[model samples]
Target: MKYDFIVVGHGLAGAILAETLRSRGSKVLVIDEPKENSASRVAAGLLNPVAGKRFAKSWLADAFIPAANAFYEALEARYGQQLFFHKPIYKIFSSIEEQNTWMAKSAGDNWGDYILATHTQSINQPGIDDPFGGIMIGRGGFLHVYALLDLLTEDLLKQELYLPERFDMDELQLTESGVKYKSIAADQLIFCEGYQVVHNPYFKWLPIQPTKGEVLEVQAEQNFSPECIYNKAVYVVPEGAGRFIIGATYDWRNPDEEPTPQGQEELSERFRQITSKQFKVTGHWAGIRPAVRDRRPLAGTHPKYKQLSVFNGMGSKGVLMAPYLAQRFAAALAGEEEVMPEIHIFRYLSLYYAYTDQQNQQP
Candidate 1:
């Protein structure tokens, strides 16, 4: 098969990039291992601008949030499926000091885009306890990630552009003009293989941290409005029909995709802190996040191989950042714009050289 671009992986980054390239008139082929549990698929799809104990706005939240909203809204209009669920996040106050922190930053205020209110009574709902009151977070919600991926996958299949198979490194040949993998040829090859990029001989030198996170689906009866996502120690996000997705335990030591008893216990204990409501576990999911050392997406062409490129490592913010980064990467690939220095894969070229030197010395 012949194509303009060959993209490996069909996760969040790959799917988004495929759409972006197709929109820009590129004949792209996407090859993916369909059985792999992509990080995007297992994610709770939580979009919280003001997370963490300090409750300050997240890094680059100002830029990424609006871009995500615009991207999803546009995608929704075209696909006729509600992919982005825009809802307020009610972050439960842990102590008087936490409440005071919110008061200083935001006070029942639209004064800021992220923090809508501090110590609002709006959080007092059935099955939820808020004595100290928590801050209401705006521009916060979850994305129906699979809905977006499914639509994109179906479109790729319809166009005969979707290849379901493992991308073998041994079969790849680098040519003067492009890359040839078996019978497939393309002008450029971009790998969005998520954490699996660590296995790529060309790009393995980049520091891509893999984190295993697990989330549980629950059937709970709560009178609380499904419109708001509750964040205490753990987040309780409603999925309608009395089903809520509660998560997540971050396990860095064991970065494998398997739901563990320890992870389940940790999530359950933290959830109990949020409320005493009895709920039954319906499902458990685990995925490995393709995180970078500096917590930014990785994009750009290889230093040695100009036709080879990578777009991966969005980490916890993958869903929120993919659409924006995909556009930026597509533009960069087309020579219309340069990939942002922050995300450019060239940033790690020194490490690649150093690793090459070490390999040479070993022999």
Candidate 2:
């Protein structure tokens, strides 16, 4: 079999890239072995405009938000499935000082577009108490990641474009013309292997500070509406029908992809802080996010092998970042425009080579 591109890994990165390439009339073969603990599959799919302790508007939020909306809307129309939902995020303020900090930050010109001037009065939900702080953020919501992945997988299967198997690097050959797989040939091969990039022989030198995040699903009371996703120390995302997905504890030291008892306990404790109602833990899962040291996505082709490329390192923001970057990556692959210098793999080429040289020199 021949294809214009062979994409390894069918997670969010691979799926979005494959779809983008196929939409451009290119033949693409997606090879993947769905890890039981892959991040995308378990992602809460929260897209927040403001992030972190400072409540800073996400980097490139102005562009990324609109692009994300357009991309998901188009996907929903094409697949006849709802992939994105607009839900205002209710950020709870823990203290008066925190509320003051948010208000101070909101007054800035750069933050004006993303933050609201006044606190929200509508409590939306009754069980959770918020006394000191409240804010309704616009242009933030949840992507139905699981449903989107399922829809994409089904569509790819229907089109005979998906291969459900692990890609053995040993079987790959870099030919003079291009890369060769078992029997398939491609003009270019790209790896969207997510956090597993640490295992890629070619890209291992790229500094990926991967982090393990754990989340839990709890059965909530029937009164809470599934309209909004609540966020504070932990986020409570409504999963419909008296169930809410709560979680996320970031652990950089323990990078394993398995859920731990401590992680579950931490999450449950955080949940209890926000609500008095008793809830039962229905599910718990953990995944490794392919976070970079500088917290920006890595893209573009290998320095030594132009035919090989990578589109990984969207980190925690894969839901918001994948679509736009996938389009840009496709353009870069097609040689339509120069890849963004800041995010290109070439930015770290010298450091990577030096590291590899050091490894070779070591006993």
Candidate 3:
């Protein structure tokens, strides 16, 4: 078998990359071993334009947001399934100072565009504690992560472009002209293995800090608005019916996917702080996010092996970052453009060279 590219992993990054490549008329094959704990499977699919405690606009919101919306919308239309839901995110102000800060920012130029309107009343109904009021944000919502992955996988299977198997590095042979992995030959091999890249001998030197996060699905007695996301100490987004998705707890020390008692208690405490309503915890999920020290995605071909490339490290922002970044990567692969300087794999060449020099000298 031969292809223009062999993409490892079927997560959002890999799926979007494969789709983009195929749209450009390239032959692509995707190899993935399904994992019960892959981050994409466990993601809440939150795409917020303004995030974090300071409520700063997300990095490159202008570009990433529209690209993401268009990408997800296209996927939804092709598959005849509802995947992306455009909803407003109502952020509960934690303090009077925070409320004042939003007021000032809302008066600013770009911030005003993102700021739909401010409310002085509690939008949480009876269960939520929003005495300081909340602000509704625009151009942000959630993606049905698992549904999108499943639909994409089905399409690849029908096209005979997907292989449900693990890619073994031992079976791979890097030739002068291209790469050979088992029976398949390709001009280039791109790895989008997410946090599992730690095991890839060829690209393991890339610093990928995998953090474990946990989220819960619960049925609360109160009716939260399904059209908007309620946030404060913890987020409770209505997931149809009487169920709401409450997430998420971040832990750097542990990478295990099993829900922890500590994580549950912490989330419960935060949920309580945000809402006074009682809820029944029905489900819990955990997965590792592929974060980086510098907080930028890693893309582009290897310094030593031009035929090998990587596109990973979107971390918690995978929903917002994947589409646009994948398009850029696909363009670079087609030789139509170059990867951005900031997220380019060349940013870590110094470390790669240092590691190579040390290894050669030791042997």
Q: How close is candidate 2 to the true structure, as a TM-score?
A: 0.95
> All predictions: root-mean-square deviation over Cα?
2.1, 1.8, 1.5
TM-score of 1: 0.94
Superposition error at 278 for model 1 (Å): 1.4
Better of 2 and 3 by TM-score: 3
Residue pairs with colliding backbones in model 2 are: none
lDDT of each: 0.85, 0.84, 0.86
TM-score for each prediction?
0.94, 0.95, 0.96
Error of 3 at 149 (Å): 0.4
> Which ranges of candidate 3 are over 4 A from the true structure?
120-124
Tens-place lDDT per residue, model 1, 143-175, is 988788888888889989998889989998999
CA shift at 11, candidate 3, in angstroms? 0.7
**What is the clash count of model 1?**
0
Q: Write the per-residue lDDT of candidate 3 for residues 181-237, one digit (tens) a residue.
A: 988999999999999887787788889988999998888775555778878877777
| Model 2, backbone clash pairs (residues 3+ apart or across chains), number | 0
Query: Model 2: C-alpha RMSD to truth?
Result: 1.8
* Clashes per candidate, residues 3 or more apart or on different chains: 0, 0, 0
Displacement of the residue 301 alpha carbon in candidate 3, Å = 0.4
